[model samples]
Target chain A: MLSVDIRKTLGAFQLQTAFDAPEGVTVLFGRSGSGKTSVVKSIAGLLTPASGRIALGARTLFDDGSRINVPVHKRRFGYVFQDSRLFPHLSVRDNLCYAARVSDRGGRSPDHVADLLGISHLLDRRTHALSGGEAQRVAIGRALLTEPDMLLMDEPLASLDGPRKAEILPYLEMLRKETGLSILYVTHNMAEVARLATHIVLVEEGRVVRSGAPDDLLTDPDMVRLLGIRDAGAVLSAAVTAAPEDGLSELAISGGRLFLPAVEAPVGATLRVRILAQDVILSTTRPEGMSALNILPVRVLAVRRGDGPGVIVQLQAGHDRLLARITRRSADALGIAEGTECYAVMKSVAVSQTDIAVGLQSGL
Target chain B: MTDWLGPEEWQAVLLSVKVSFWATVLSMPLGLICAMALARGRFLGRDVLNWLVHLPLVLPPVVTGYLLLLSFGRRGPVGSFLYDTFGITLAFQWTGAALAASIMAFPLMVRAMRLAIEAVDPRLEEAAATLGANRVRVFSTVTLPLILPGIIAGAVLAFAKAMGEFGATITFVSNIPGETRTIPSAIYAFLQVPGGESSALRLVAVSVVIAIGALILSEWLSRRVAKRISGA
Candidate 1:
């Protein structure tokens, strides 16, 4: 576990934040200029806190009271910047070996880390030649060679485009499975939060307003405004129940069987699929005519009316919770209230390939 | 067959090369250290030290040579101490000529190096620090390699400046033949004699060739270093 309680004043803005980072990927999720990056910098010793204490497990990294601030290099934390800060002068091989030369802790060989990140082919290439995603992977590999107690990633994928992000997501998932290293990922992207966050720390104006498991906050109606109406959604723990039929794989989610566009996994493989609130449609009563494939009977957990023309309706479908972001007029017309039964409708192909991701493998 | 340059002219050419080489080599470390301090270090008298470095460029060459003669002459305080302690004398020697050349070229070297160091992104150094490198290691592995092209440019600039150094070298060392007289000093000597235009012109051509050669070498070296660093 890593503890951070830091207060810094930058220009006119004052950043005061406190949080505990437990095991697994604890993401510092916030919008731009929300002091998320400042918090990460403080942990890396790039930015000093005015008054606070930062501790990593048994060792204390910083304490303003005691005036004990360990230098950045000795802190032994791997930091991945938003821009992959690879030494342009060095080959991929030499760049990975840099930390090993100076550090006694956890510097692994370039070949071994390259194999782990699937970047063995890129070892001889110059860093300038690699694509954005490829560079980030190499950056991750270089950080891993440092053998850090925890990884600090400050929006590692923010600079990449859609296709590039898709290419790198699998490698990130692989890291979670391959290593027991603690990661404090920083990003404002809700999609990344839904996909990668085992724990989420939401910051607003330099304050952590919410902290908990991804499942709870994702489904909470209050978080809808922060996670933008279009991006806010429920993440379902699902498993492949049947093979692809008509180029669609059937997944057994909590409410019912979900048929998605051919998941690349065998039957009984567990995954996490994000159902964007905007993709879901609410129905007052069961009607026959519909082009949509999946419609589940849901109970309205709560009604959160927004300042805008929309409303985020918290829902319960079997053992899982889902959120449907509908307009206020639609909510009134359908009379969605707490415990009110409704059918949540969605198209068979609506769940995007990027939305469906790998999660915990619970005896699958 | 032996008409390319007079024997004295040849001696001057070789002496100029020797003086310029020593000047460039001896002053390079001080130039780099001062440049690093000016670019990154924050300390008292920093502005004063910066002004002192560029003083040679601003001051007239004759005045600088006079000051060197006063302080580093055999009878002067520093010169007497050196002569008494180790029996080493910089006064009226080829070494004194090199010292004058180095003093004149110091500013150019420092300026080039400081610009390069300032252009380097500090974030890269920070990244190295996080990778478990101390300040020295970070500088050696990251900062030094990144600024190598600049260092080369500085050294080459100083060498070229030292080769052409005239007023200070002549004023301080008195242009003694085969000892302190370099190419420029030899060119001046030939111009003084009646009907000596051909000899002076020949020495002038040699100086031009050496300066042009040095420029080309610096350009080629800088390009190669950049290629190796950028890995393109």
Candidate 2:
């Protein structure tokens, strides 16, 4: 477990945050200028806080009361920045082995790391010759070779294009599952939060507003306003039940069988699917759907009204909580309130390929 | 080529090369230290140190030599202390000439190196530190390799400047045939005689070749190092 409670004042921006990260991936989710990066930097010892204590398991990394601020190199925490900070003078292989060579405590070989990141073929190439995605992969590999106590990633995918981001997310997922190293990932992108976050810490204006498992916080109606109502959604864990047919694959969730776009994972593999609140249509009764494929029987858990005409309706479908963004008129007409029964009508095509995350069942 | 010049003229050529070589080689470590301090250090007296390092570039070479004589002469404070403690003297000796040349060349060396150090991204060093590299390791592995081309350029510039050094060398250490007489001093001595024009011309040719050769060599070395660093 990694515990961080730090307070820093940079000009007018005063940041105070406290959070705990267990062995899984804990994502610091916030918009730009929310001080998420500052938290990560403080954890990595890149920026010293004015006051607080930080510790990893039994080791105290920083403490103002004790005046025991461990230096960055001695902390043994791997950090991957937004930009791929590979040394230009070094080949990919040398960059991967840099921390190992310096620390003389390499836990993994360069060849093994390269293979894990799918960069074995590019080891001899110069960093300048690599594509953006490949360079990031090498950067990740470089960090992993150190065998750090924890990994700190500060929006590593923010600089890449869509296709490039798609290319690197799988490697990150694999790292999370295979390494079992506690990771602190920071990003403002909601899609990234839904896909990567096992635990989510919501940061706002240098303060942690709320934090919990992705399933709980994402489905809470009170958090809709903070999570960018349009991007607010719940992550549903399901296992692939059938192979892809007609560009759709069937997955079994606690709610019911969900057919989404062709997920890359094979049958029997569990996956996390992000359902956007805006994409879900709430109906009072199970109406005969003409074209929409999914209509699950649900009971309204809570009704949250935003400043606009839209209201976020939280529903319980079997054991999973789902959110639907419906206007005031629709909510009034459907009589949607706490304990009201409804059917969440969702078109099968609304869920994009990017919304699906291939989660490893056992590791999670 | 061996017999193209007399023994005295050859002595001047060899001695000049020797003085300039010592000047450049001996001053390098200190030059690098001063350059790093000027570029990255944030202590008090940083501005004063910067001004002091550049004083030789702007001051009259004769004045610089005079100051050296007053401060480092045998009877002077540093000079007398060295003589009494270590039994070393630099007055009118060949070593004095090398000292003069190095002082004259120090500014150029420091300037080139400082610019190179400034051009390096500090972020790379921070990344190395986060990757388990201590300060010494970061400097050796990242900072030193990145600034190697600049160091080479600075050394070569100082060498060239030392080779052509005239006013200070002549003022600090008087011309001695086999001891202190460098290429410029030799050319001056040869020109002072009635039938010494040809010898002076030969020495002039030698100085010009050395200066141009140093420039070209520095340029080539810097370009090669830069290319390698950029991964070309």
Candidate 3:
């Protein structure tokens, strides 16, 4: 377990947060300028907090009250910066082997890490010649080769374009599955959070507003604005139950089956699908002859009114909670309230291909 | 070579090479230390140290040499102590000429090295530290290699400066045959006599060729070192 609790003041901005992240991928989800990087830096021993304590397992990394602070190199936590920060003077093989030699972790070999990161062919090349995604993979490999107790990534993919991000995400998933390395990843992008985060800590204004499993906090209606209203969505863990029939595949979700437009996943593969709140429509009565392929039977959970004409409604279909944003007039006219039964309608094409993540080998 | 240059002129040319080579080599470690301190040290008196390193460049060469004579002449305290303790004499000796040249060229070396150190990003050092290398290891492994071109540049400047050094060498160590009479001092002596212009010009041509050769060699060395360090 990696636990962090600290308080620091940088000029007028104050950082005060506390959270315990378990062994999987714990994502610090926030917007830009939300102190996500600061939190990661403190945990890596790069930024010293004014007070409070941080510990990994039984090891006390820092304790201001007792005047205990472990220096960065001795802390044994690997850090991957957004820019890669690879030593330009060193070859990719040497860069990966650098920490391994200094760290005295002879268990990890350069070839092993290179193979794991799919950078074996690029080992002899200089860091300046590698692409952005390839360089990030090399950086991650370098960090892992140190045999650190935990890994810290500060927006590792933020600098990449759409295709580059796609190129590197599978490697990250592979790392998450192959090695049981605990990761503390920071990002302002919700797509990464939905794809990789097992535990999500929502940070806003240098404070953790909420912390829990991604399934629990991501569906909360009150967090719509924090999640970016336009990008605000719900991630539902589903299994590919049937093959494509007429360019549509079926998924078994918590509530009922959802037919999406030609998901390329194999049968029995678990997928995480994100549906935007704005795309979901609510009806008290099931409408006939609708072009939409999905109409989940849901019971209203909560209604949160934003400072606008629309209201964010929480609906529970079976054990899963999903969010739907509808106009206040439509909500009032349909008499939507807590415990009210309704049908949530969604079009097959409304779920973009970019929003689907093929989860790990094991189902979510 | 001897058809145009006399035996005495040959001795002066060879002696100048010896003096300049020693001056460049002997003062390199001290130059690097000064450069490192001036570039990265945050301690008190840092600005004073910087000013002192560059003082030789600002002061007249004769003044610098006179000051050196007052402190390091044979009868001077340091000079007397060395003579009594180790039977070594510097004043009016070949070693004294080398000492004078090193001092005259020290500022140029330090300035070149310091600029190179300043160009190095401190973030790279921090990254090295994160890799578990200590402070000393980081400097040797990450910093020293990167600043090699600068060191070479500094050494070359010091060598060329020492080769051409005349005012300081004359003030500190008087012109002595086969000892203190370097190429420049030989030219000066030959020009003082009647029918000596041809000999002086011959020595002048030799000095020009040596200086150009040193410049070209230093340029090539720095480029090779830069390519190897940057892995380009």
Candidate 4:
């Protein structure tokens, strides 16, 4: 377990955050200038906190009260910056070996990390010649060669284009699963959070407002406000119950049944489904002859106004609270309020297969 | 055919080369240190140190030479103390001429090196620190290699400036044949005599050739270093 409870004051910005991350990918999610990078830097010992205690497992990395502050180099935490920060004078091979040669820990080898990151072919090339995705891959390899106890990635994909981000996400997922290295990933992108995060720590104004499983927070109404109305959604874990012949697959969510576009996963395999708030339509009574394939009988739990002209309706289908956004006029016409009964209607084709991600075991 | 250059012209050529070479070699390390300090160090009186480093550039060369002579001449306080303690002498010697040339050229060397050092990204140093390199090791392996082109440029500028140094060398060390006489001093001597115009013109031509050669060599060295560092 890696735990950080730090408080630092820099001019006008005050950072007082406390969070314990288990041995998995704990993503710090927030908008820009929200102190996400500050928290990660504090954990990596790049920025010293005025007063706090930082510990990783049995070792005490920092304690301001005791006047114990380890230097950044000796802290032995691998940090991958957004710019990659590769040594311009060194070849890719030398850049990968730099940390390993200097690290006090003797377990990690440079060749092993290079092989793991799949950059053996580009080892002899200069750093400036590599593409953006390739540079990040080499940066990851350089960090891993240090044999750090934990890894801190600060928006490593923010500099890349969307396609480049897509190219690197799978490698990050592989790193998380294959190495089982405790990772503290900082990102502002919600799509990455939905795909890779096991736990999400919501940060705003230099403070952590909430921390929990990704599915729990992704559907929370308060979290929807943090993520904004356009990106609000419900993350549901489902098991592929059956693969029907009509290009649709039945999924068993916690509260009700969901039908998604045909997925390649075999029957009985678990998958995650993301149903966007804007895509959901609520009706007071069961409608007939509609093309929508899935409808859940739900009770209106709460009603709240969104950022613009829309009203957010919280519904309890089974054990999950699904959010739906509709204009205020529609809410009034449909008479949607708390304790009202409604059928949540969504097309099977609208439940995209790409949104259905398969999660691995917790430790993996 | 006999050699075109006369004996006096040849002496001036040889002495100028020796003086400028020694001046550049002696001042390069000090120039690098001062450049690094000015570029990287954050300390009290940094602006004052910066002004002092550039003082030789703005001040008249004769004034700078006079100051050096006051501090380093055999009879002056610092000079006399050294002479009394260690029997060292710098007044009216070729070494004094070299010292004057170095002092006059120091600013150019530091400016080139400072620009080069400043051009390097500090983020790379931070990255090196995270890689477990100490401050000294990071500077040696990363900072020095990155700034090498600037160092070469600075050295060449200093050497070229040392070759043409006149007012300072004459004021500090004086013109002594076979001792403190360099190209500029020899030119001055030939100008003083009505019959030595041809020798002075030939010596001036040699000076021009040396300056051009130094500039070409510096360019070649800088490109080689840049290519090596950039791995291109």
Candidate that scores best on TM-score: 2
Model 3 spans > 4 angstroms off: A359-364, B1-4, B216-232
Q: Estimate each model's TM-score.
A: 0.95, 0.97, 0.94, 0.91
Superposed model 4: Cα runs more than 4 Å off: A240-252, A255-269, A284-287, A296-301, A306-308, A316-321, A328-342, A353-364, B1-7, B216-232
Alpha-carbon runs more than 4 Å astray in model 1: A358-364, B1-3, B222-231
**For model 4, how does the per-residue alpha-carbon lDDT over A49-145 read when each residue is reduced to its tens digit?**
9899998898888998888888777777888999998988889999988887878778757778778777889999999899999999999998888
Report, for every candidate in turn, its global Cα lDDT versus the true structure. Answer: 0.88, 0.88, 0.87, 0.84
Reported per model, the fraction of native interface contacts reproduced equals 0.86, 0.77, 0.42, 0.56
Model 3 alpha-carbon miss at residue A250, Å: 1.4
| Candidate 1 residue-wise lDDT, A133-220, digit = tens | 9999999988888899899999999999999998888888778778878899999998888888889999999999999888898999
DockQ of predicted candidate 2 = 0.69
Pairs clashing within candidate 2: none
Q: Across residues B1-232, which tens digit of lDDT does each residue of candidate 1 receive? A: 2568878878888899999999999999999999999999999999999999999998999999999999899998999999999999997999999999999999999998887788777999999999899899899999999889889988998999999999888889898998998989988888899977888898888778878987887777666556655556
The candidates' interface RMSDs, in order, read 1.8, 1.7, 2.3, 2.2
Model 1 root mean square deviation, Cα atoms: 2.1
TM-score of structure candidate 1:
0.95
**Which candidate should be chosen as best, given lDDT against the real structure?**
2
lDDT of 3 by residue, B1-232 (tens): 8766899889998999999999999999999999999998999999899888888888998998888788788789999999999999888899999999998899989987887788777777777776677788889888887888889988998999898999889999989989999999999999999998988999999989878987887677667556655546
**How high is the lDDT of residue B37 in model 3?**
95
